[model samples]
Target chain A: MADRVLVAKLGLDGHDRGIKVVARTLRDAGYEVIYTGLFQTPESTVTAAIQEDVDAIGLSMLSGAHLALVPAVMEEQRRAGVSIPVIVGGIIPEDDIPALTKAGVSAVLGPGASAEEVIGAVRGAIDRARREAGGSAPEGEPGGSAPQGEPA
Target chain B: MTRREEWQKAFEKAPLRDADFETMSGLPLEPVYGPADDEDAEYPGVYPYTRGPYASMYRSKLWTMRMFAGFGTATDTNWRFKELLAHGGSGLSTAFDMPTLLGVDSDDPRALGEVGRCGVAVDTLADVEDLYAGIDLEKVTTSMTINSPAAVILAMYVANAEANGAKRANLGGTLQNDILKEYQAQKEFVFPPRPSMRLVADTIEWCAAEMPRWHPVSISGYHIREAGSTAAQELAFTLANGFAYVESALQRGLAVDDFAPRLSFFFNAHIDFFEEIAKYRAARRIWARWMKERYHASSPRSMQMRFHTQTAGVSLTAQQPEVNIVRTAIEALAGVLGGTQSLHTNSMDEALALPTAKAARIALRTQQVIAYESGVANVADPLGGSWFVESLTDEMERLAEETFSYLDDLGHGSMLEGVLQGIEEGWFQNEVADAAYRFDRALNSGRRVFVGANAFTEGNDEDPIEVLKITDEDERRQVKRLAEVRSRRDGDAVERSLASLAAAAADPEVNLMPPLLDAVRTYATLGEIMDRLARVFGRHVEQPSI
Candidate 1:
């Protein structure tokens, strides 16, 4: 089973060069990546993440609206009962990273992040989410088969 | 063996180690350049223009130092404009905020937090007035960098200029109404390619008849390069787009000579010094030849390629930010040696945020230094006879012709159809993406190096550079201003004007500028006019291809 990751761009900023590189790197690392192309809203991103059942989601925003857009996605994901971790990346200033993390972002990758660093972050984030999801499941459940690996 | 042959043999045996020995476009480089390697070259201001568009080049008049600037509110930008002019900035290049570029008013909910963050915010004709207040529109040439809503913005400019008692014929400036590049690279397109192209044609036709000194469309490859493309791809794709616009105007019954002279170009001055120079030279030769042979234009003005070059923003590094100053200086020199008519040097801090005033001043000074101090501008095409530059220029021209032929075939012997087909099939975007991916992969693998970014470790130095920050309060002010304008304007006039625009849009033969100007004069917001047009011409849905 391949680890499925969903990548998305939020808001009016159309800078996808960084996001596309990240997506390609993740895909090359054997993840089934679903990319939500530019100009996606928070609602559309959350809907796609839930529908795809992605193991993890990555959001990239270069426009300064990340503080507003990211929390909206976090809220939508929470309402949809999805615990999938979402990583954010772009030209985020250092001061805003902690705020994004506090708003439920798993990790924040800024400019100049190497491919290896991005892959390591995404893989580690998914592994941590899977472990926590596995530990919280009821014992002896039919669907409780080791869900560590991606169902896709 | 002869002494030269022996020297060549020794050089081959002990070649430079661990070096790629190729240009960024994958063209192989030789050990040395000499007269024997020089290609046949034409003189400057000649038919082909392989050397340059003008015979004297910068000796007659220096290239205009047109810096792209805008941020915060319109009044804020207006102040910047006045300061730039006072500081010897030759021309104005306007940059709009995301909402205005995306055809949304500053007050829209989707525009929250993004308004005035990237560039200036202009919601209605009132904002445009404030933007150009006290500046003589007739004297100072302005270049507006808006695409999706370019018609609305241009209409606003024309209306504002008229209101200020400036004759349309006396106005001089360029409208970067290039919708093709928006679909291909900038990704700020509102309508589909077909109708968006029609709107561009309408502007060109209107300008050809009304505004004698105005450049209706600046076919741009700057965004395509900024989006990540090779120098060759930038040359090829941008010229293909120019050809597409020419065809669109021709289809509208305008003669080739009528608008081609006013047709300008915008290109990115990437850090590759020799390559960027060759790209510009090759661009002139290719455009001149095509305009004469293929398009059958007899006018020499129509054949010459005049362009504005901006130092590549993508090449700037956030790590060791000040190193970008040197990069911009080199790129500006390349643009001058390549015979650009106008140039903009990017601020070092752009990768982090909109440039602070200090950084922007440094950028303008970089251009001024090149213009005044750099003796390289004394000669027209100083590298005209250089074996290496001439060969590269020839190779680039040949490669661009190949791309042109491919697009022509796709368009069924029409560059217009080829561009339309390319946009619909995502061919242009895919090509740029592939080049970008290759560059990124090479950079990541250490096959290529970007001085401060990929190499030359700074060890995470804590150098605190002041970045220009646009606060949420700016957005609030912009929205309030927009609301005030809406409250004051006559609702009935706005309604009638919008209906007229929608009607004009529905008819294929109707030129949209008149009704568009009418609507803008009624204080109809950018989004209102754009929304009405979108109601008639459906919004574009990008065919996602990663």
Candidate 2:
């Protein structure tokens, strides 16, 4: 997660173990991480995303709530006319990744993914969006390169 | 010769460290320990049994391998339970979800989304029936990891055991029935401290008579450690809570010999290796001494403090999750070597999701490897007499004693004061934040390196581990099943039991256990029992969140 990337735990999955680590890592890498505590429905998650005006929304879920939760969140984003890139994280099986991505999720992150890989994916997605929008790369955003452990 | 200056001069970094630089859970760790550390070892199975409860320890039977298991419905997790037993796990540890733990039923509105989430959802005796589906309660020991509603769940277990043709005297298991720590760390609670204490004392008194083989409560320091308290804090707080419970039970007129022997403990095995081992040794010494000196608990079993240990899940990283297996293995070793009676190794993929079957099996294998492959289990307290370990253990015991004395002087070790003043005023949370921030800063400045998280650059490899997913249909099915159980049960009997529970709760001396057992017998779901109590006790709003 970059400074602009947004992170949230979607649905009633209150397990913060994964997302907290992700947030801390991304924050250490200079990404502004927002933590939404337990029991958030998809609507609240998307609403928060729009309000934060973030560059990306990271959903850390457990509780097998992802199948119902992710689609609900995507629909909530559409209904709100917000297309901020969405990234899904948590107990996501490999088979569900394609379906999640096909449902407009920018990327899918599972367990064991290094912080660098998560950073690289979010930055690449963000950089691609900026390129399509015809905006110049933010000076300190590192031109879509993955960040190392140290903040640049 | 001030302690702070003395350590500063010895270590050469006094100016840079916090005033009380120590391991989380508050053990003041030395930069290094050498020779001259257990010169004062106490007699085993006696006062200050610093080494362990029994003289021979694992030279006796090694502590039972009880991996924590519970998820989905009772029937679903019962299947998992049988699998764990088949795979060489010697005991069963049951984990209930937030709702069931809070005394709520699966079909209750508050429990809807939470049902079968963190662990299994047990709503009634039938659900309890599903949990033991085919297992014999008389032969195998079980641990129910619950509080707040511990008595209710325990009663359910008793009823289910009777139905399965096992006498209460023959059943074996532990109910993590401790509640003082619930206010201190875990936020789940049902009644005020007074009523809660009564509930626990009632269970202790009853079990002392009816369930001779059962462990009524596992006084827990595991949650405090998990909540980021220092090792010293964990030891001190857990012991203080134990003292409080003992004092409360005394109020009910149960002799120490009757209940204290059955008391057990639970602890967390964090990443710090030597520090954790010392913490366990320190705990035994502290409890043994206090039981004899403070409460005059004379029986050897009453003096001994035995515990179950779980490898720290908080230490598991979402980044490079495979590393968690390595971490869990090391932590499990620490627990076994420290003399834990049971243990649960965390899954590598835990930082991401509920462990898929592959991850869970790997977690189990980690324990088996430690128990069999690792030569450490060949002897009891393998590092017991090491000079460094002994000295650190002494330091841990001394510090925990001082901390407990400080709390004792401030007032009684009341859970309300501890949570209301200590926690709400941010003493507990601030200490945790300070430790967390220090660790974070150390990582940022390169003082500490989390292998895959920070130093290692296998940065491109994706976490290919499969994850377990639950569906909305599961929730709907649970609700439907609960509704069916409700409609088919004798509604009039259920109402009578619920009403009786309300009356019991109204009077402090009236034991709520019998009514609770009756409610479960009448097929009351967990949520319904909780709702009835909430109607009588009303919900307790938590103190302002930090």
Candidate 3:
């Protein structure tokens, strides 16, 4: 079964070229990608993430609001009790990466991330989350099938 | 046959260099252009404006170097504005933060974590006052890149200038009050397309009567192109939107000449040198012809298409950041050759973050070098007679005309109706998305080469460039200021003004600018004014598609 991933734009930034490209990239890589469109609040994004029951969440923020917005998303994830891996991509400053990583972001992709880098980050984060879950079935995987190998 | 045969014989006798001989957009090129390729191109400032808009071009008055600067608090951005002016920038172009651009207040929950980050935070007229504290609004022309709440922001500017003793009539600048592009590309819209357009028309109508030197709408292709559109799509969609604005103003009973002269354009000077130049030349020709023949515009000023050009932000690569300076220089040169009235060169560090002060100055210096050091400005449309350039210009015109025909048929012969229907059905968005995806696929497949991203990537990893930081303190200070203004202003006056504004909004007959001015004068916040209008007009939520 394909690993389902949720992609969202949190905050008022409407620069969606990066997010749309990433979503298509993930979809082309055999992941069933769900995208929540522009101007999504943190609560709305996390709620969609939980309801969709995806394996990972990719947040795209280009408005330089990630420092404030990402932490809010993390808090929402904790409150919702969903321990999914969260990855972020956009124009993120290097100095802020430590704080974002400390806040539990699995990986941070900057602008112009190659397709391989994007896929690798998501796959690595998902594998880490699955291992942390004691190799349990992904909570919402249909028929409880084990995760399949990466598609070529 | 005599001159042509002689030139052809000479051209065939010479050895050609080993090069791609193709444009950045993959348009095939000829080795040399000659008089045979000429289409009897008009002189500069002539009808159709194919050569250039003004007779002298940059020889008499060089293009205004308008740097887009804003971040942190009003004070921070004001300081930057002063620095830019001191550093020889000819004009000011304001970049409002996301919260302000989306018409939300600093304290609004939706504005959390995004205050004054992307641009300056303006919650009320007070912020405008602080933003231009020492700058003389009359002496300097300002261009505010805000839409959706554009009328509100314009009202603030007007009120701020008046408070500072600047005559409203003498004030000059442009408002990017173009709303159709908001629905199509930028996605910063507050209300539905119809009412949002009404706001645009209201501003145009009000500006026509009051502000003589002010441009009510800067029909923009910059954001459309930035949203991953092809060069042709950018040209077509932007011109179509310009026609729609003209139609809307005419529908408001204003004469074509009365308001059309004040309408301006903004375009993107992407990395494609000849393609960008052709796009500009084609845009002016199309606009001039349409205004004169279709709209029956008699005034030459009404027929002319004047625009400001900005270097493509999307073209700036995050890798090998310094290379962006070279990229910007090439793009800025294209703007100059294409006859832009004003220009803004993107800083090298923009891909990583907002530019630091040094980076911003360097971007300005890139323009200075082109304007002064480079000899390109000495001749108006120096490439006007080139076979390659003339052919590309004609090809762009043909492509844009085809788009106009399709849109006209869709709108039942009305460009305005066509754009509205296209936005409603998501046709424009889908087209842009498909183009963007195609480009991405080409890039991934190594068919397209981006310098550091795809090819020549040795030593790509380097120390991260230092970026401008907007700290939490900026947000805190802005919110405090907002609260202070709210507490000190006359509560009754705010209510009355907002009430009147709401009443005017409900009536399609009343122009919303006067009441907007009244509300801002009473310290009514942007959020309050926008919310009041949203109650009557309703908010717009796009149907998202992949």
Candidate 4:
């Protein structure tokens, strides 16, 4: 079965062009992508992520509220007892990357991230989470497989 | 042979370079244009306004250098405003933060990390007072980019200016009170489309009677284009929204001329130079013709379409940050050549974060260079007669007209109804999403070349620019300030004013402006006022779609 990923836009920023394109990119790469639309709070985003039972969550934050919002999402994930790997992408600055990473973000993609970079980040995060979990892939999902077709 | 035939013969005799001769929007172009291509000979300040809005464009007065600046708290942004004025910025354009834009207070739980993040945070009239501080409201025109809470913000501005001894009539500026685009592009809407549009029409009606110099609605295509729409989509959707606003105002029994003159436009100056220029020209022509013929607007001022332009923020690449200055310069030049009334250039560091002071200065300087150093501003519509430009303008008009026809049929011949129905059906959102996906696919497939992104990607890893950061302290201080204002103000007055505002909101006949002004004067917070209205108007939650 293909890996399922949930992409969400948390916070009040409505700039969804990046997030929508990323969703399509992931879906085109054979991942069953579910997108949570605009104005989603961190609590709502994590709830959707858990409900979807996806392999990973991709958070798109362009409002410059990532530092406060992303950590809140991480905390929500912990509270909900879901150890889902969360990757973020948007207009994130270089200085904020370490902090986001330190706060348990698996990968941080910038605005100019290409399709390969986005796919690589998601796959790497999922792989890292699997390895950390003693190579136990999610129930019926295949463990180590490349995305079907490379983005042309 | 005539001059046209002779020029055609000469044009064919000369060899052309082996290149794709087309406008950025892919409209094919000819090597040279002659009198045969353009025979209208319309001058500036004429009917249809295809050439330019004013007779002596830019030669009499250059376009206002309005920089969009706001971050952290009111005091922080006020300092930036003064600095911009000191640096010769002709006008002020305010950018409210997410919470404020969403009509919530700094302390609201929904605000969480968003307070004072994207733009300035305003809780009450006190924040507005601090925002303007020493800036003379009468001398300078300010444009507030707020939509759902635009009427509330306008009330605060009016109360603040009056408290500062500024007459309401003498005060000048624009309010981006356009709500249709909010449902279509920017998702900061608080109430549903019907009530939200009532707020817009109320503001326009109020401004027409009270603040003549104030522009009630800046029908915007900037956010639409930024949301990944094509150039033609941007033009068509924006003009359709403009027509909707006009219809809304007319429905309110206001004469077309009474409020149409105050209606303005805002467009995105995307990287496609000729395409952006053509969009602006086509915008004026379409607006003029529609207002005169369809709306039966008799006044020439009502027919003219004056717009403010901002350089496309989406075109700025995050890979080579500094190279954005060149991109901004080209876009700003397009705005000036397109005869914009005001302009805002994006900072080099904006793709990552809010612009640092230095980056903002460079962006402002980009506009200064175009206004003074570049000779493009000297001639009104310098590209008006070019074969490529004229043809592109006409093509843009045709494309926009096609969109209007579809919308008209959808609305049963009413543009306003069409837009409202389109928003409900998610047609606009799907169209924009499809366009954005196509662009991304083209970029990924190497069909579209973005410098330093898809091509010429050497040394793209270095990040040298310093981005301005809004610390948590700003948010905390803003919350504390809101609390203090709440505690100090007369609690009874706040309750009474909010009650009256709510009552007025329940009644469709009562214009919400006066009650909003009364509420803001009582120090009722934006959140309180919005919540009261939401009780009656209801909150809007869009049906999420990919």
Worst 10 residues of 1 chain B by lDDT: B32-41
Error of 2 at B296 (Å): 2.1
> Which regions of candidate 4 deviate over 4 angstroms?
A138-152, B1-40
lDDT of 2 by residue, B1-546 (tens): 433233234334212312333444666544322234432334344356676676545544567888788878888799999998998888999988767777766766556566787788887888888899889889999999998889889989999999878898999999998887776666466776556767788899889988899999999988877665778778877887787778778878889878999999999999899999999999998888888987888797998899999998778877777878889988999999898888888888776666777788888888878766655554446676688998999899888878676666555554334433454354554454445445555665668777776678585368456666655565777777888898899999988888899888888777777788888899977777877776766665443321
User: Residues A32-73, candidate 1, lDDT per residue (tens digit)?
Assistant: 899988888888887887667677889887878888889999
Runs in model 2 deviating more than 4 A are: A1-62, A66-152, B1-40, B109-114, B190-195, B318-322, B356-359, B412-426, B459-463, B471-473, B543-546
**Each model's total of backbone clashes:** 1, 19, 0, 0
Q: After superposition, how far is residue B468 of candidate 2 from its true place, in Å?
A: 3.7
Error of 4 at B185 (Å): 0.8
lDDT of 1 by residue, B179-243 (tens): 99888898998899899989999999999999999999999999999888899999999999999
Predicted candidate 4, C-alpha RMSD = 7.7
Off by over 4 Å in 1: A131-152, B1-41
For candidate 4, lDDT tens digit of each residue in B1-546? 543344344344445433454554667654333244554465566667787777656655789999999999999999999999999999999999999999999999888888899999999999999999999999999999999999999999999999989999999999999899988887789999999999999999999999999999999999999998999999999999999999999999999999999999999999989999999999999999999999999998998899999999999988888999999999999888888999999999888889999999999998888766655565557787788999999999999999999999999999999999999999999899899999999999889999989999997978566778789899999999999999999999999999999999999998999999999999999999999999999999888888
Better of 1 and 3 by TM-score: 3
Docking class of 2: incorrect
The Cα local distance difference test for each model comes to: 0.86, 0.73, 0.89, 0.89
For B1-546, candidate 3 gives per-residue lDDT tens digits of 343344344445445433344555667655333354643436566678776777656655789999999999999999999999999998999999999998999999888889989999999999999999999999999999999999999999999999889998999999999999988889999999999999999999999999999999999999999999999999999999999999999999899999999999999999989999999999999999999999999998998899999999999998989999999999999999999999999999999889999999999999999877666676668788878988999999999999999999999989999999999999998888888888888888889999998998886878767788888889999999999999999999999999999999999999999999999999999999999999999999988788
Model 3 chain B weakest lDDT span, ten residues long: B1-10
